[model samples]
Target: MPHSVTDTTTPASHPTASDTSGRTDALHSVPTGLYIDGVWRESSDASTIAVENPATGRTLLDIASATPTDGAAALDAAVAAADDWARTSPRHRGEILRRAFDLLTERAEHFATLITLEMGKPLAQARGEVAYGAEFFRWYSEESVRIDGRWSTSPDGKSRLMTMRQPVGPTLMITPWNFPLAMGTRKIGPAIAAGCTMVIKPASQTPLTMLALADLMTEVGVPAGVLNVIPTRTSGAVMTPLITDPRLRKLTFTGSTPVGKDLIRQSAEQVLRVSMELGGNAPFLVFEDADIEAAVDGAMLAKMRNMGEACTAANRFLVHQSVADDFAALLAQKMTAERLGAGIDDGVTVGPLIDDKQRRKVAELVTDAVDRGADLTVGGERIDGPGYFYTPTVLTNVQPGSAVLREEIFGPVAPIATFTDDDDAIARANDTEYGLAAYAFTASTARTIKVAESLDFGMIGINQGIISNAAAPFGGMKHSGFGREGGPEGIAEYVETKYIGINPLDATVRNSHTDAR
Candidate 1:
C-alpha cells in the first residue's frame, strides 16, 4: 500500500538525539517541495508525502507530493527545454556538470547526512555514496565534449556518408531508493551530458537526497526545465501518463524486474527508447585455493555493504568444500561484530532496513532458510525497537533449494553453500534468472580467468568485492535488465544515431565544367 499524503502545513518535529545521533540540524535543513522548471513549489493539489527516518520510524519531514497533473507539467517542462538544451554548446554543458561535481564535493557532508536520514545507510557508507555519486558528474562532464560521431565515404564511390548522435530528447528517469544519491547521479549525469532534458521521479522512500541534489544543480546554474523533480507517493499514478505521452522520448529506470517490465510495456506504445537496471541475485564464489581471510573480507564487503540491501549484494556465498567451514566461521564472526543501529550514530556499521516492509521481507527469508535445514550461524532475529532494525544474519549449510539461495535478499543476511569444483561453482552461480553481478575469490590466475569468464553475470569481481566505478560500464544481463550506466557507454543510452549520405557526382560535374572553362 502507498503512504497517505496530507495537506497539513505544520512541520514535523525532529527526532530525538538517540534517533539521529546528533544530526538533527542537518535533517532539518533538507529541502522539501517539488522542483519544476527551475522553481520549487507545492504539488498542484497541495498534497505532501511524509518523509520518514527509517532509523527511528519518525517523520523527518514532508515533501510536496506530485499528482498526474504535476507529472504532465513536468513533462511539458522537459519537452519545452529539450530543443534549446540540445542546441546548447557541449562545452557549456560540460562546464555546468564540472561545477556541479565540485559543488557536490564541497557539500558532501550535507548530502551524506540527508541520505543517511532518509535511506538508512550508515553515515560512513552514506559518505562513501556521496563520493561515488559525485564522481559521475565529473566523469560525465568529461564525456560531454566527447560525444563523437563518424564521417566517411560510402561503399558507392559517388557518395559520402556521415553519422551523428543527437539527444533522444526529453527523457523520464526513475531511480530506486537503496543508493538514492548514486542512482540519481548515474542516470542524471549521463542524461545531462548527452544534452537530453529530464523529468526525474525519485523513489518516495528516499526523495530527499535527490531533492537536495536538485538544489545543488540549480545553484550550479543548470537551466530551468533541463531537470525537473517530482516526488509522489503514487509513482504509477504520476508516471503512467508521462510514460505514455509522445513527448517523453526516452525512459530510464532502476528498480525491480517486474516494475521495469511494466514500464517497458508502456513505453512500447510510443516506441520509446528505454533503459532498465533491474534486480540481481549475485553469487560470491570462494574457491579451495582462496585465502580464507581475504575471501571473508570480500564476503563482508559484498554481502554487508548497504546492509545488503543492494541489488549487487552477494545473495549466495558459494565456497569450496575444503574451506567452507573456515569461510563461514569468519564471515559469521564479522557479521556478528558489525554494530547495527541508527545510521547517524557514531561507530555504527549496519543500519536499519529501509522500512517495516523490508524488515519483514528479510525476516521471512531468514525464517524460510532456517526451516529448510540451513544452520543459523548467528544473528537471525529482528531487534525490538522503534526503528526497522534487523540483525546481520549468517546461515551455513544452506540447502540448495532454500529461498535465500534463489532470491535477492535485500538485507544483511549471508547464506553459505558449498561447491565441489570450478564447474560446480559456475553452474550454481548461473542457475538464476538474474545475471547482474557475481564475485569469485581465488589465488590461482588460471582459476580466476576460468571462473570470471565462465560466470554468466554482466559484471564480475575476480578477487575484489567492490566492482562499481565511474570509469567502468555497470549493467546486467538476462532478467537483470538491459542497458549500461557509467563509463562512455552511459551517455550513449540517452542519444540516438542518425546517418546522412550525399552524392558527390554533382560536385564532380561542377569541378569538370570549371576546369573546361
Candidate 2:
C-alpha cells in the first residue's frame, strides 16, 4: 500500500492545504476507462491498477488496466477513421488543433497543478511545461496546411514527376512519465495535424494529465475514433496487440534507449514507422574564455529544471581547467540554496524524486561515484520524511571512469570535471552511448562555431541555456534515437511520401534521398 501525503484523519481539501484538499476527488472524477471512438468505455478486462502520487506515495486513483482486446478495439477505431480524417481539409484539422492550443492556454494553471501533484515537479516548472506543450498544437496547426511536396519535370521536357506527402495512417503514441503532458501533445499534435488517427498511451505514473488532455480534445470537437487514449498498467498486454496489428502503421515513443530497442524489434514484425526520442546524458561545458557568471546562470537553469529529470538536463559539467574551481564553488552554492519539499507547495523550488525506487537509484549512483573517488562537494544524502527526496548534490574530483558521466543521472546531481581545452572537452563530452543534447559557453565566435560543429549531439546550446521551442527540432543522434520533433520537420514523422509519374511523349521515375521514408 502507498503511504499518505498528509494525515488520514483530515478531510481531503486543495493539494496545497494541510488536509491536501480533494485532489484525489478530481482524479477520481476523471474517466479512467479506455477512451475509444471519442467515447469512454470499459476495458475487456475489468481489472485496474492504482496510480500513486510520487511525492507522497499516496494512491491517487486506480486506472483501468487494458488487455490485448482493448488494444485491438482501439486499433480498429483508428484504422476506420484514418482515411476519412486524412481526406478532411488540412485547414479543418489545423483549426481543431489550434483550438486545443487555446484551451491549453486557458487551462494552463490547472494542468500545471495536476502535473505537480502527480509527477512532483515544482508548480512553476509544471506551468512552463503546459505552455511548452501548447506550442506543439499551435505549430503543428500551421504546418498542417504546408504539407506539400516537390513538382518537377525531366530534362527531356517530355515527362512530368510529382511527389506528395500524406498521412502514415494510424499511430501509437507511447510517452514517458517525466514530461507526460508535453511528450503526448508533441506526438499527437503532429499526427492529427497531418491527418493521422492515433491512440495515446501515457506512462502509468502520470496518466491523469494525458487523460485530461484527451477530454479537452473531445470538447474542441475531435471526431469520433480520431484520437484515443488507453491508460493501462501492463505494457505487454496492450502493446502486443497494438504493435502486431498491421493496421497500426506507426509507433512514436519517448523513453529509455533499452525500451526503444525492444520496441524497434517488435515494430519490425509489422515494419511499423517508428519515431524514438530516448534517453540522454547531456554535457554542459564551460571554457576559460567564457563569462563565468553567465555559465553559472546557465548551469542553474539547465541542471535544475524539473529537478534535473529532463532528458535535456545537464548530467555532467565539463569546465576549463583554469576556471574549474570557481565554477564548482558558485554552482554548489546555488544548488545548496534549492528548497526541497512537496511540488504543490508555492515556495518549494525543488521537489522530491518521483518515488523511492527513483530516489534509491539516484542515491546508488552517488554512492558509486564516491566509491570511485569522486569528492562530494555538497549534498550527498537523502531527506528523511514521508516523501521521496534527496538533497541537490554536487561532486568534484570526479574520476574519468565514474559511472555518473557514463549513465543518465536523471536527478539533481551535478558532477564537474576539468578539461585542458576545446578538443579535450569535446572528446570527453561526446564519449557516451547517448548524444541527445550538449551545451557550451564561449565568447569566441570561432570557438563557438568550432565547439558547436564538433560536439556530437542533436541539439546544442551554445552561449544559451534554453534551446527547446515549437519552431526548433527536438531530438538526438546516435543511440539517443533518430527523428526530429517540435519543428516544421516534426510533421514529417507522421507523413509518408508518394511519387506519381506521367507518360507524355516520354516517361521517367525521379526519386530523392530524403524520400527514404
The candidate that wins on TM-score is 1
Clashing pairs in 1: none
Candidate 1 error regions (>4 Å): 1-20, 506-517
Task: Estimate every model's Cα lDDT from 0 to 1.
Answer: 0.88, 0.85
lDDT of 2 by residue, 354-469 (tens): 88888888898899899999999999778765778788899998998888889988899999989997899999999998989999999999998998899899999998777889
Model 2 accuracy (lDDT, Cα): 0.85
Q: In candidate 2, how many Å is residue 37 off?
A: 1.3
- Residue range with the least summed lDDT across 10 consecutive positions in model 1: 1-10
Q: How close is candidate 1 to the true structure, as a TM-score?
A: 0.95
Considering every candidate listed, which one attains the maximal lDDT? 1
Per-candidate TM-scores read 0.95, 0.94
CA lDDT for candidate 1: 0.88
